[model samples]
Structure formats: structure tokens, C-alpha cells
Target: MPIRAGEWLAHGSQPEWTMTVVEKTQGAPRDAGPLAELDDHGLVAACLAGRRDAFDLLVDRHKRSVYLLCYRFVGTHEDASDLSQDVFLRAYRGLRRFRGDSSFATWLYRIGVNVCLNRVSMRQPLQRSLDEMPNLAAPQADPAVALVRREEARRVRAAVARLPRKQRTALILRVYHDLPHKEIASALGTSVGAVKANFFHALANLKKLLAADTRSGS
Candidate 1:
């Protein structure tokens, strides 16, 4: 999923909440100037100083990753898009609270994880899997092989989703995002030891879940 700048949240089907928040904080458009060269922290400073375009650049840099994280949790484009937008909206409102203790991306990930967990808690478990099987299968691949692989992938995803919250989050960050334990600890607001423990337990539990599924022929 290639996320174009200003396109995902601008879709007509997006929730009304994002529109209100954007209208309130969005500054007038201007030329990129030198702001494009800035790092995340520099961009944050620029945004706080009223350079709204700086925030736009930050969005362009991180939105795809954020959307993917949300998609992994929710298993659908619509819900992921909504949750992604909500995460950014919260980040924008809480910009002042971003104390440079972690990298901007890590801070954003924390916000994204919290938003995803809250959304997941309020809804029933997702039965649909991510729309990524097409990418996994080659154009000329056997249909039966592709079907089997897709089903396996779906079951794996469902199993991951069912893990306890900390375990699930730790696994996703470490495996999918490739974040180191130290960085994951920062995003999760825990120590590295705790993150490692959760990750180990997550892998153990996931293996058991998959083995059970295989036994049941599900």
C-alpha cells in the first residue's frame, strides 16, 4: 500500500473527526524551503513554531509506517485508515507533551500502539486478514499453493492478534517493525527486560496456537 501525501485522510469516506482536527491546526501552505531537510525533532520544533507544513512533511515521512501498524492490528483498510488518522490527530494535539526522551518516531509509535489497542478493545476480534497475499504469491503461481499459503498467513495473523496485549504489541514491534528491544521498551513504556520477556512469551504462545490449529485442521 503506497500512501500518497494528503490523500489517505482526504478521502471522502474518512470520519468527520479528522476533518475537524485538521481544519483547526492546518496552517497555510507554503514552499518547502529548507524545512524538507530537517530531522524529526527539528521538524517538531518547526511545527511548534507555527510551520504547519513542517508537520505535513512529518506526516508524509511516517504515515505509511503508521498506517501499516494500524492495518496489522485491525486487518482492514477502512479501520486502519481511521485509526491512523486518529493517531496523528492525537499526536498533533499533544505535541507539547513530546519530551525528547525518545525519538520522534518512537513517540509516534507509542501513540499509535495505544490508539490501536484502545480501538481493538472496543471492537470484536477481526476475522478478516490483511490484503497482502497477492504480494506473497507470484503472478504465475499455482492457485492451490497460493490458497494454502494465504490461509496459513491468515491463521498466523489471527493467532498473533489473540495474544495478551503486551505480548502481542512486543512481538509486532520487534518482528514486524524490526525495532530493537531498547527502542521497543521506550515505545511500550517498559524496561528492555520486560519487553524481552513479553516477546519470548509471545513466540511461545504463538507456536502453541499454530500447532493447535494444525492439529484441528483449521
Candidate 2:
């Protein structure tokens, strides 16, 4: 669980069974995450000028959050890493086109949602397999309580994944990313009103499904 350098990844049948081993406890201070030495515009400029190291800084700051979002959307670690990589690659390609009208973080997440949507569309919305969720919560003293909590989180995530792609993107952007509705609208190339509409419907549908689940104990 240590965030050390040169970790080895070992995966079992389920992602929860996978683990990492760190070779070193610490690294250089320069590798520390981007603490806003450059604004979004400056970073983008450096990236466009072929300073690849600048892009690495951006990724270090946002990759953890972005990968977690992808894992929630796709329900698998194998695919989430791929999706996260794809998101960064797409952002790299599109950096030249980014008008700087929006913050670069917002631009990156906009692309992240689109990548997740494309991934979901390739599979049937209702065909989620629930045996592979990764447990990121703190471990509970009682194993039964931990199992129940993990199962409940997986069920909720599956329901969210099944939503229409736009609605899912809207809800995750606004909720997980803690993005404002107005910013989400700009990211998705829509209006604030449309973002609200998606969030409203997405929340309503998820609530209904989760309520039914509680009643049935599924």
C-alpha cells in the first residue's frame, strides 16, 4: 500500500486479489506531484512545444483520480488502466486544439468521460459482471461488514455504468470529480441546463434502482 517507486503488480482471478510491492520507500523530491508551478496554459504550452516531461507532470497530478473514475465506469482494472492510458493519449493528441477557454483539468476530464462512454458502448449496458470489483475502502474489523460494503458499492457502480452514456458522464463528472455543473456543461460541449437535466434523470434512475435493491436484498 506504500506509494513507493518501482512497484510490481501481481494479479489474481479478481482485482481485489491483486497487490503491489514497492522497491524503494522514497524518491527524489522533484518527482513530487505538480504543485502548480505552471498554470494550465503554461503546461499546455510546454506540452505543445514537445517537452514531454511537462505532460508527465500533468499525468502525475491527475492520473490517480482519472484511473479511479475509469475503474468505476468500466468495472475492471485491466480495462481501466487501458482506458486511462487512452484518455491521456487522446489528450496529448488534442492539446493543440485546446483553446484554453476552459481549465486544462476540465478539458482532460471531458476527454476522460468520452473515453469511458466509448468503452461502455462497445459492451452491452446490462451485461456487467460483478465478481471483479476492486476494494479501495478502509478494511473493516468484521469481515462480514466489509463484504457487505464492497458488494453494495459494486451494485451501485454497476447501476451507474448502465445509465445512458451522456447521463453517466454527467453524473460522474459532477459527483466524482466535484466539478461544478457549469464547468461540466462546458467540458461536455453542452449548456448548464442540459447538464442539470442529465444529472436529474441519472440520479432519479439510480435512486430507484438502488431502492429496489435494498428492498429485494439482491
Candidate 1 structure lDDT: 0.85
Residue-level lDDT of model 2, residues 13-36, one tens digit each, is 333443456556332225434634
Clashing pairs in 2: none
What is the Cα-based lDDT of residue 177 in candidate 2?
A: 80
Cα deviation of 188, candidate 1, in Å: 1.1
lDDT of 1 by residue, 154-184 (tens): 8888889889999999998999889999999
Question: What are the lDDT figures for the candidates, one per model?
Answer: 0.85, 0.79
Off by over 4 Å in 1: 1-30, 129-140
**Model 1 misses residue 200 by how many Å?**
0.3
